[model samples]
Target chain A: MAEEVILLDFWPSPFGMRARIALREKGVDFDLREEDLLGNKSPLLLETNPVHEKIPVLIHKGKAVCESLVIVQYIDETWGHECPLLPSDPYERSRARFWADYVDKIFPVGRAAWLSTGETQEAAKEEYIQGFKTLEGELGDKAYFGGERFGYVDVSLIPLYNSFYALEKLANCSVAEECPKLVQWAERCMQRESVAKSLPDPHKVYDFLLVLKKKLQPQ
Target chain B: MAEEVILLDFWPSPFGMRARIALREKGVDFDLREEDLLGNKSPLLLETNPVHEKIPVLIHKGKAVCESLVIVQYIDETWGHECPLLPSDPYERSRARFWADYVDKIFPVGRAAWLSTGETQEAAKEEYIQGFKTLEGELGDKAYFGGERFGYVDVSLIPLYNSFYALEKLANCSVAEECPKLVQWAERCMQRESVAKSLPDPHKVYDFLLVLKKKLQPQ
Candidate 1:
């Protein structure tokens, strides 16, 4: 029997892009239902993820999978015969998951850069730049975080490309200038059909961020 | 040849306790090297986990795996021969990982409850209590989160039992009174040798917390 796969997602969400990219990479056909995150959440979204009530819930064969990384791992495991996302070796898999998790852990630094101002903004930007250096060190001339393969860490992080321009403008720092290799790496990722299709226009994302910052800061 | 396993950990840490429980559950013989986190971090700990330098690093045959949850997952995948921590089915595995991630997510609320003071503390306590209630709802009369087996979610969460008394006193709430079922489930987990041996005495943890709070927030 063919699998029924449905994704509950918001367009601007990096997390949703992860699921989309993974599904596309795995060659899985899924029904994408755009969510009204700013307005009322759908009954399906609410029911599917009663705990988080967040987007990027992948419903496969009637069971809901929440958390983008977990869902991405699920997609990989289920359709691993085609394009394997995680490495087969246990140690390599642990490293992949580790760096992917690092992406999540460092997000607050970037977030605070945009959402805050003055001393707080300066501190966040400095922290984010330091975090970027560490990430760059990790990248270290590898074509991809997966080291020559567009796999787990690539899928986990490339979504953040959508917010790069907006963050650069708001945070008053150029990621391209700060981490040239990372920017190059992101461009390499964007060239892929899966990532190209999964990501929205960077300009559109910037516009959305402008509205969001005004709404959130209102100053 | 037998695999050499060494754990870089702190005796009081819930995170460290998680790694210990997983190792115990797998019946893997490992040398436990306790770190003086308050003092100087050992050279091995520094070398093994240069990224986080945090406790609960599982060093298996010279490869270091940092992050408690990641280490636990590694242990499960590496020695999945007996007492599987994560389920075999992809969906079940995703759910297990999701709930474990959720446990890590809600932890900041509990930490805030103990760390902060005044209005912030009150807010954190309220948030922590609300989060606990949600966890209790998830528990829903199950013998364990894995339903009759003390598995991933069990290993992920049971370590928090170490801080229950300290959290209760500092936050001005009773977990036993707030979520009776959760407390009961914790008690059930405590009966197991893995848990009993892993956790420190509750009063001792509370005393440690007193010292920690004074050090962190001196008046």
Candidate 2:
């Protein structure tokens, strides 16, 4: 039986990018249904993800998988014959899940650095930098967060690096300066066809954020 | 070599109870080191989980696993010879992860209902009930959130039910009244020795909440 996979997603969403990168890496042929998140979400998106009404919702053979990392794991497990995203060992898999979970935990702090204003923005930026340094410590001299290959934690995080330029512009911070090793890692991830093709241009993301910031902060 | 397992936890914590329940369900021998969250956290806890500095850390053979749900999954995988917490099927595992993630997402909303006051409390209570109803809809007559046997989602949520009595007192609501089916499911979970023995007394939890509420509200 043939498998049918569809992703309901918004472009420029790091969460959505994780699923895209995972699918691309697995060499899976899937349809992309771009969503209008700022406007009315598609009925398909709403019906598929009634609980959160959020993307990227991965519909596989009519079953909806919500949450980006969960969808990535689903894709990896389902198409595991081609490429394995997570480590096979239980301990290593747990470590992969741990780092991915850490990325989830710190996302709001990173986003707040760009989205917020004044003292809140200042505090968020400091915390975000600290978070990056912590991740740097984890990365160390390793080529990838997954160690040898571009795997789960890499897929989980590399997507966010797409918006780093935008985030830096808004927050007046330098991720490259704060965590040079992580910046090098991001550059390495960009060399991958899966990650490069999945991510939007950094300058375009920065331009989008300029408009978004006006809407978010107001004059 | 025998597995050296230790759980660093605080009583009355639903998150901590999850690890206890999972460990018990797996029939794994372990030590419990209670933390004084109100006072000083143990140096061991500090060194082990420096990132979050939170409890319910499962130290297996000297390696620490933080985050309650992640620890539960680790226990299930490490001791997978019996009592599999997560489903083996990729699709079902994805669904379990989705629901468990949903529970994690709504926890702050549920916690805030009890922690806040006046209009904020009212709003949080309303949101919390809505979230519970959403979960109830998902349960839909299943014996556990995992459908047949008590499994991942069940392990994820049953711990929270331990404080239902306390939450009810603080927010002036009844899970039995609002979510009758889910309340029944909670009762079924309580019959399990794993869940039954791990949870603290309901009245004791409520009394603890009274003290906590005074500290939180500070009239």
Q: Name the candidate that leads on DockQ.
A: 1
DockQ (0 to 1) for model 1: 0.88
User: After superposing the true interface residues, what Cα RMSD does each candidate give?
Assistant: 0.7, 0.8
Give the least accurate 10-residue stretch of model 1 chain B, judged by summed lDDT: B168-177
Model 1 scores a C-alpha lDDT of: 0.89
DockQ agreement of candidate 2 with the native complex: 0.82
Q: What is the C-alpha RMSD of each candidate to the true structure, in Å?
A: 1.5, 1.4
Query: Residue B4 error for model 1, in Å?
Result: 2.0
| Residue-by-residue lDDT tens digits, candidate 1, B1-219 | 237899998888999999999998888889999899999999999999888888988999889999998899899989956679898889989989998998898788888889998999888888777787888898898999878899999999998867888888877756567888998999999999989999999899989988999999888
Model 2 vs. true fold: TM: 0.97
Docking class of 2: high
Give per-residue CA lDDT, model 2, range B28-134, as digits (tens): 88899999997899999999999899998999988889898889888888895556989889889999999999889888987888898889988988887888899
